[model samples]
Target: MGGKQQHDIRHSDRTPAALGYSMPPEWAPHEATWLAWPHLASDWPGKLDTIRWVYTEIVRKLVPGERIHLMVRNAAEEARARQYLHRAGCPLSRVLFFHHPTNRSWTRDSGPIFVTRSQRPHPRAIVQFHFNGWAKYPNWRRDRQVPEAAARHLGMPLFEAFWNGRPFVLEGGAVDVNGSGSLLTTEECLLHPEIQVRNPGFSRRDYEAALQAHLGVRNVLWLKSGIVGDDTHGHVDDLARFVNRNTIVMVRESNPRDPNYRRLEENWELVPDLRLEDGSRPQVIALPMPAPITFDGYRLPASYANFYIGNAAVLVPTFNDPKDRLALGILGELFPDRPVVGIHAVDLVLGLGTLHCLTQQQPA
Candidate 1:
């Protein structure tokens, strides 16, 4: 592999897209899945114990499909995670633990965005973009180190993403790729100035250019906003996702009185007119939103759209709502080859995210 040689080259001079690398679709075959073990009590507060159990359940479901590479703070944390995994009956042979400390367990935002180039000397590499605690939260210094540590551990070349000669901030959950030159994102997350000022003075056109240069995408479909309770401003993973190159699974709220109803409806309307890279419109599938889940009067982000697609199964976030079964059935039809397993996410969402928010896939 040209991993060492590519590491010597300065990625600051060129973008990953110019180097013939692009982010793959989630449904693609993965070598492993990366996760950070939940350790911070402040993230879950009163629900930490239940949240730990949910994390173990998530590990149990994913281990059967692909290797799970977990990040722990230290040897003690690793031992604790091992005990939990063992009790959960996860296949120990398929799991590996790394001593990488993180402030929070949400790996989707802090983790490296893995890219691939079929003809390159080193087929696999990673894009390390700046992360600023979603531009709202603090205590992210340790979380920011995750990408470089992960790249070193995996022996993959790491490329730093920049805009106007400065590092740019972008989370993996903020954008979804179709692996066919089309990208899906929201204007609320990337373009919202006051909410999450990711890159100062970056406009919509500037973002599109940066995405094309870094992600190798020809078309970008921007939704207006996300659901009501999404604290990351508006992560597209909680609102919409690309199931295939020509299809999208988006969230839709049925009850008109709900706060998310209007925004989701507006986003749903835009999908039919959205064109793909090939100039053909994509097949839009509307996924149901679960009933509002609240703790201390705050609505948690509990959309089924946060499901993670793995090699052996599609891990869905299921709230104990009537719509959970409906969402599973719809996704089951979409991913006929993979088993649709619902991991109860009522406790997981207490941290404001679910399956897709906690895991990052490494393409094979």
Candidate 2:
């Protein structure tokens, strides 16, 4: 850990990668999971109350495996959350509450991205990326403070990522890593020039350099785009994810007329050509997309690829569709170490995200 000014890596060579730190795969053991308690009614519209219970269920499932670092706005909010968790039979002692206010509850996009070093005294550190509500929403000022607060709370060294003297903007959901130096992302999220542009004027090379410096990535696999109605533009977690170092689970839409059919197919075709960090081709498995879910004239991003891998369980979002069982069975085979649990996410997706989007894992 360094002094406040020294932590900013804009003018220094002490990047996380330079110090041997890399973002761990989600399947790795976690000390705890960070979650921002849902309080904003605008995000879930008419389902805010229902969404809190969803949080309780998630906590109940995860607490047996890892601690829950839950952020709440104030004492009242914490008390309300406690009541819900208590009734749900979630162990209260396993949860640690922080009075950290946030505009939204999606921690994957706004929270600190923790990286780890293998053989160091202080192995864990926080790589604080500049978050701007995914560069799509205006009410992200509070969300931006989450990383710094997290770093202080955990007593971990904080490294501020910057490119060309400006803070670099990135979201956790924008990239998925294999913990073996390979990363998966979509061009629509990082390269699209005019649509929800993050770090304007940054090219592929610039992004690659920044990613290598911060996350220790040696290879980047770029997908064409994401499914329809994803507000984050093209988050990769909604389309593809690394189940293991050598396997990637990607979503494929069978319905030819579906809006995501072509986009997913184009990405699926590229998978065979992609290589892992060690120059070996990764095993690609196809995951089915749930039928289009429409609410208030909006088609929510409801792909099964947005599942979260927890230490106790692999939580997959289920939309009460016929494909839910098939998706769970596929994931169950891939993750034999942990139980594959399907989380009811119809109301959760009304906020435009589900399991993986709402949670961020803290590597142990």
Candidate 3:
């Protein structure tokens, strides 16, 4: 299935894959992590102040490992962020601020998707996949300009993704990579026909083609769905993530009565049958789900799988639940090289996401 041609195409043959460029895994060495300052009060309701502290903690944890490229609306907002970071004892030297304005602060969905060229004088480039508020919100025009802004600021080449001559819509949270050719995604996010559909008529093959062309993905392992209360309509980040090239941590719920139990169970069952790009089965480990977090009568998408991997540490979101320790232990064992720290996210999830949802990694 294809849509009507909506834009002019140039450089159609210089796809990232054809040029030997690939999107690296999060665990790969990063030049910096990209974050947008929390400015939208409506996303966190009355919890925006708390969310700013959450951002501070995230910055504090990651700045030790790599530089933080923070985006702010203007000079005033940058000053506000500086004050917060300064109070948190974060080293301002490792934090760089950008004056790019954003409608919302979920950088993982709207920020630049960086790809690397192994055999180049120019080692890095960005693939600008059109992001339209996950196809569920209205004020995303500013967010959509993020990739171009990043490319312009870094003086790197930017490649616009297109499928059937139309701009391809993708959110970085919808897929996870292994730094190899394998990719993890869910049908519920990219292939759904009606509900928050990203591409209007794209099929599995179409997605595979688009991903290969843009991100150098060869093996597309598809999970059936994501957990309950995911407003992004089944982003892969909340259900499963690659802790290493050969291993995946898929979230599981022990309670059968929970709304997320069946959905996560289906994904766990499907993982064993999937293969990586090299035709080897991935080692699947079950990560425990946090107890359902509800605020104002709504279930929040809070899972340990939404952890962010930094160069210095793995920052996992904790919900003040007992299983928080267990989740940290499991991740700690897997990430022996660095400490696996937990960031309190009870108030942060008022915006319906946690750690991984707010940050994007830029490959070194």
Candidate 4:
């Protein structure tokens, strides 16, 4: 592994017409699931121990099925994480931690976007992009520089973009691809000019062009909003997710009084009965949203859409509400090969997020 500052992963020698970089499916062989060790007690408040247990349980479910690539900031956190994994009886060999520093444990949104080629074997590279704390959380300078460290540690090449010689803003949560060209995202989060500070030269077109070049995305489907109380404004992950090339499971609200009922209904109508580049409308399914979990009168973002699909099992966030079982049943049907396990996210959401918000999966 070698250290290089802001290494560009894209080779300028090839044109988009000449280059053949298609986004591989999520189920493609994963080297390991990437994660950041939790440290900030401020995010968990008094129940940090319970949060660790839940996170440890997540590793327990995933490590048996596949490898776990974790990120630890310091020696103490690393030791603790190692202890938790050991006690959980996870395969020690499969759990490897890199000393990459991060501001928080949400590696999925902040970590490197690792994409691979389907034709090639064991080819893993990282995509380095700019993260501005969703333009909400202002203290994430260290978090923004994660890709450089990840590239050096893994000895992989980096792909940095320069469309219009201007920077682009995108989060891992804001976009989900079906391994084909079509992608699912929210216009509220990605295109909100007032919500984000963009480079003077880059427009929405510039951003889409960059996506085409970097992630191999083609047809971009724009959704309206995510579940309310989400801090990232409205990341698509909390509203919709692509489980396979031709199937997507979305979160829906049934009660009229619920704040998300109308927004969720509109999103349902917006979901296309259309096809992919392969010409097949994705099988659309619905997973009901759990009862709004609140702390001190303020509602926390609670949705079944925040499930993290791992190699072996899908770790879904449960609110201990009635909808928990229904959500798991739906997810289980979507991922028949993998077991659907639920984690009580009632306490977790007090931090303004759930499972999907906490963990990021690294594709093999």
Q: In candidate 4, what are the lDDT values of residues 139-166, reduced to their tens digit? A: 6888888876777777866666446665
lDDT of 2 at 67: 98
Evaluation by TM-score, superior candidate among 2 and 4: 2
Model 2, runs deviating above 4 Å: 1-12
- Count of clashes in candidate 4: 5
lDDT of 3 by residue, 118-183 (tens): 785558888888899989899999999999888878877778999887899999999999989999
lDDT per residue as tens, model 1, 147-219: 8888888878788888887787899999999999999999999998788789989988889999988888989
lDDT of each: 0.89, 0.93, 0.91, 0.76
Question: Could you give the candidate ranking by TM-score, starting with the highest?
Answer: 2, 1, 3, 4
Show the colliding residue pairs in model 1: none
Model 3 bad stretches (over 4 Å): 1-12
Clashes of each: 0, 0, 0, 5
Q: Considering only N, C-alpha and C atoms within 3 Å, which residue pairs clash in candidate 4?
A: 8-158, 9-158, 9-159, 30-364, 31-364
Distance from true location, Cα of 208 in model 3, Å: 0.6
**Residue 163 lDDT in candidate 3:** 84
Better of 3 and 4 by lDDT: 3
Candidates arranged by lDDT, highest first: 2, 3, 1, 4
